[model samples]
Target: MTISAEEAARRPLVSDEQIEDRVADLIGRAIKRKWWILFLDENGVQLPMIVPVDGAPLVPDEAATEHSIEGLRVIMDEIGAAEVILVWERPTGSTVTLPDRVWASSMARAARDRGIRVRAQLISHRTGVRWFAPDDYEGHLEAS
Candidate 1:
């Protein structure tokens, strides 16, 4: 027996959890490359998530004083917390970038299901020098 194109087109939709899981896997890889991945909630609130990436080799302990990669992340954490504490600085790029909106949508959906009001925004990761980078949110409000 042969399957028809019309029948093939009727395949069932994938579960949201499946999609989210796949994204998590790929995103995990992306972050490990020292790339910044941002997170936003439903209410447009931004949160920074550090991909499990390590920065480049230190040129020297003395040279380290000059380079600060903190600018890369919007949020700072160990990258394994449900509720992250942040200490992110404003980005310098001309165009404002939105990161992890899909995650926000999923989060919002989950939150709303539990009858919770929500916010959304971009999230990025930064280096931690002392104790998992304090989750102290630098700004109370997002400028953009």
Candidate 2:
């Protein structure tokens, strides 16, 4: 079925209310998961301790706005050869996206240059989600 452009435009194109709701959902997951994330920025995965970080801006990442790559692809690269990626709960969570994708993209490029294998993650705050890494998580970043 072909909907008219006018009708399509009328559709909510990511409203603040929607964004807030989405972010809130992520926050709930973060709390429930206990946030043992692999914080993959354009710079690759950061230290685990820094993954759960609530504040401290990440430079309004340019990668966050990227449109070429898919989140699942980025995730697969991080998983490497692992059969099970021993991650925090809700393993299907993939909010690391465009306009928010830049950070991870930059870190990913950085990791590529540095030849560092990484596993990055996102942590949402009142402002927005930030990056973190399981390597920096320390002391069993996960509950299990």
Candidate 3:
């Protein structure tokens, strides 16, 4: 169920449900761990420059996350993206875990620190893509 970036960009991803469905289609049963960055236009339409961060850790490390955030800022600025949606794709079960919470928390904090607007933080597991509920990441928001 994979789709090209051009095709994906043509679709409006304004809602969490739309984002989840599109991410699920793009990821299509992940075979490895990765982080995907979806930059959106001011109207919430996705841009064609989808970035897949290969070799991301199952449990993201602080240094790597910081570096990635810096990179994201540069890319967003270059393309004048209004917002970003992050998707952590992993070849694991669908049930949310501590690592998932931590990842979401870390990304939220990093984006906030950089003044980057994150539309959503999602997880694409073996089963499908889903948003990270506030409760899933609230506790870990201040962690580290």
Candidate 4:
């Protein structure tokens, strides 16, 4: 079951925990591998639009990552978004893998390069949702 845009817009995803819970509710327990972007207003309230990048590679390609981020930037600007929260959804275990780190780093770098602020990075797996801390992608930054 999916949530209505109105309901999503009413919620303020200000904290990491709120973002994680909202993402978990959005994707649910069963899901395919994909990337989800939760757009937030300047006040940290969620926007009605949630962008999903389907069929993305676990180990993202540099060019593709940049292109995707550029597209997202356009959308953000059009919608007056102030920030975005990235969610990596996959039907796997909760353990953070190398590919996860790479994806997180790539997404973060691409967004940063485009002058987009990322509120938080998260991963939703079989067990639950978990945050991608700075440490999670520090080493993978160079590789990305």
lDDT of 3 by residue, 50-143 (tens): 8999877778789977988899999999999999988878889878888888878887888888899989888888777777776778658576
Worst 10 residues of 1 by lDDT: 128-137
Q: Give me the displacement of residue 121 in model 2, in angstroms.
A: 5.0
Residue 110 in model 4: lDDT: 79
Candidate 4 residue runs with Cα over 4 Å from true position: 1-4
- The clash count of every prediction, one per candidate, is 21, 34, 0, 0
Q: What TM-score goes with each of the models?
A: 0.21, 0.28, 0.87, 0.89
Candidate 1, residue 110: lDDT: 40
Against the unseen true structure, what C-alpha lDDT does each candidate score?
A: 0.28, 0.34, 0.82, 0.82
Tens-digit lDDT track of model 1 for 11-79: 321343322332333232122322223333332223333333245331213232123223222232233
Best by TM-score: 4
Worst 10 residues of 3 by lDDT: 135-144
RMSD after CA superposition, every candidate: 16.6, 15.5, 2.0, 2.0
Ranking of predictions according to lDDT: 4, 3, 2, 1
Q: Lowest summed lDDT over 10 consecutive residues: which window, candidate 2?
A: 81-90
Measured with C-alpha atoms, the lDDT of residue 141 in candidate 4 is: 65
True lDDT of residue 88, candidate 2: 28
| Model 2 regions lying over 4 Å from their true place | 1-28, 31-51, 58-96, 119-144
Candidate that beats the other on lDDT, 2 or 4, i.e. the better one:
4
